[model samples]
Target: MTYCVGMLLDKGLVLMSDTRTNSGVDNISVFRKMHTWSIAGERVITILTAGNLATTQAVISQLEERNKAPSDRRPSIMEAPTMFQVATQVGRLLRDVIEGRQDGGMQGEGPRFTASMIVAGQIRDMEPRLFLIYPEGNFIEASYDTPFFQIGETKYGRPILLRGYDRRMTFEDAVKLLMVSFDSTLAANLSVGLPFDLQVLERDRFDPLHSRRILASDPYFHQISSGWSEALRQAFHSLPSYSFAEDSTPSDGAR
Candidate 1:
């Protein structure tokens, strides 16, 4: 399992993905799940992958190959005319890879070779876009009604994003919100671990405004994890206490 979030903000896009992957407790390893491609002043594309490692790696490798040697054989994401087309090509490739692998494997386990991705980026004049691509080769773009996308180990951290996300928030605050979300997930799931990859792509800029690999020993993340835990404890304590006596229900404000 993994945890990857792509937040669509008015400023641009913010993405983070955990690096942990494992076949079992003793077989854990770290590999980057976040991949990005940019053409200086033309476009920027970032993908956050989750699920079967082989399936995801194959899809990424094909994309990189296409970029390095463009042709009609396969449409390179870098050459896709629009962000929508870039997402379409990636989704198609992901679906094909999974299906192709399954054809060579045993029955009743097609899902084990499946994967999904979050595609976020912008082309020259268009507004930045965010998409969630499924293993079936279909996708939906983020909108005001749904302003963010999360894949894998999503349950533990989803509530934080739901309650805290705001389109008008600053980039700094957005990253802070993501840290809290990732921290909560980290505490709840062993499959999702440290050294998260983070990126910020400002609107209209074909290059990343900020890019970083946050290690377990990173000071800022350490503070966010510890402080968020303490804040939750304090908030719990501050809530109105319950009473045992009959006819002692708390007031509406307390409720």
Candidate 2:
């Protein structure tokens, strides 16, 4: 399992993904789930993946190979005219990879090789866009109604995003928001362990404004985790206390 978020903000895209994979408690491992490609000043693309690691890796490897030696028959994301086209290409590739695996005898009652991805980025002269690509090659875009996408181990961290996301928030605030979300997830799920990868892409830049790995030793993330816990406790206590007396007047039902 993993956790990855691609947020659409007025400033551009903010993306993060955890680096943990485990078949069992004793067989845990770390693997990067974030992948990016760019053409300097022309375009920049980022993908956050979740699900079957083998399927995800195969999809990413094919994209990398295309980028390295793009041909007319096998076009690269860098050549895609728009962010939408780029997303379409990625979705198709991801679907093809998973289907190929299923055809190779990894089907029936065994573990299904499926995966999902969040594709976010911008092309020259176009606004940044965000997409959630599923194993079936279908996808949806982030819009005013849904300005973000989350894949993998999402339930634990979704509430934080629901309450805190803002379209006009600063990049600094966005990262802080994601940290709290990831921290909540990490506390609850063993399969989503960190050393998270983060990237902030400013509008029209065609390159990442900030990129780094948040390791276990990262002081800021530690602070965010502990501080958020304390804050939640304080907020819970501060809310109006539940009063049994207020609920003791159920005369209609009792009668």
Candidate 3:
């Protein structure tokens, strides 16, 4: 399991993903789930993946190979004229890999050979875009009403994003918001351990504005995690308390 979030903000795009994968309690490993491709001043694409590791890896490998040797059947991501086309290509590739596995005796009824991705980037003069590509080769784009997309171990962290996301928030605030979401997820799930890869793509830059790996001991993430816990505790206490007087036995006299 993993957690990956991509936010489409007025200022730009923010993407973050954990690097944890585990098959069982005794077999745990860390593998980066974030991948990026860019042509400076022309285009930049970021992909965050979750689900069946083999399936995702195969899809990425094929995409990378196609980029190096473009064929008529498989167009390179770099050749896509728009971000939408790039997403279409990725979705097709992902579906192809999963379906191929299903054809080769892998069960299709469950998560076996299934994977999903969050795709975000910009093309030259086009507006930045974000998408969530499902295992079925279908996808949905981020919009004003839903300015962000999260994949993998999503439930534990969704509430924070629901209450905090704003389309007009600055890039800094957007990254902080995502960090809170990731922190909430990490506290609840061992399969979603850190460190995390983060990327910021400023609008129309056609390249990453900032990118880095956040380690377990990262000071800012630590502050965010502890601060959120304290804030939640304070908020819980500040809320109106329930009154028990009506339900009480009226002091054994007024009843």
Candidate 4:
């Protein structure tokens, strides 16, 4: 399992994905799940994938190949005219890759072949957009009512996002929120480990404004994790204490 989140904010887009993949306790490995493509001042695309490694890798490889050699193939993500088209192309490719594998030799209902992705980017002169693409090739875009997308190991960290996300929040606040979310998830799940890939794109920049990897021992991440834990403790203690009515007298027969 993996954890990836993409947020569509008024400022631009924020994305983060963990780099851990595991088949068992002893078979864990680190594999980056974030991929990006940018044409300097023209456009920028970032994909955060989760699920079957082979399926996601195949989808990414196909996209790269198409972009490198567009003559005999359909439009690649880099060539898509709009963010919507980019999501469409990626969804189609992901579905095709999974279905092709199932048809080739794997069982039809094998869960290991399933994968999902969060597609986000900005096209020249167009607003930034975010999409969560399912394994079936269908996707949903982010809106004010739902301005973020999460894939894999999502349960543990969703509460923080639900209560804290703001469409107008700054990129700095957004990244902090994401770090808290990822930290919460990491604390509860062994499948999701550290060394997260993070990217931030400012509106109209047509390129990433910030990008970096957060390692397990990174000072900032450690500070955020510890600070969040202390804050939560303080908040919990500050809440109104529960009260119960005191018994006025002993039971009639107990005295």
Per-residue C-alpha lDDT of model 2 across residues 86-144, encoded as one tens digit per residue = 88999999988888877877787234688999999999888999999988999999996
Q: RMSD in Å for candidate 3, one decimal? A: 4.2
**89-189 in candidate 4: lDDT tens per residue?**
99999999988888887875667799999999999888899999999999999998999999999999999999989999999999999999999999999
Task: Give the TM-score of each candidate.
Answer: 0.96, 0.94, 0.93, 0.95
Cα-based lDDT for every prediction: 0.94, 0.91, 0.90, 0.92
**Using lDDT as the measure, which candidate wins?**
1
When 2 and 3 are scored with TM-score, the better candidate is 2
Winner by TM-score: 1
- The local lDDT score (0 to 100) that residue 197 gets in candidate 1 is 97
Candidate 2: segments with Cα more than 4 A from true spot: 109-111, 246-255
Q: Which clashing pairs does model 1 show?
A: none
Could you tell me which 10 consecutive residues in candidate 4 have the lowest summed lDDT? 246-255
* TM-score of decoy 2: 0.94
Q: Which stretches of candidate 4 lie over 4 Å from their true place?
A: 246-255
Q: What would the per-residue lDDT of candidate 3 be over residues 104-207, giving only the tens digit for each residue?
A: 87665546668999999999878999999999999999998898898999999999899998888888888899899999999998899989999999998888
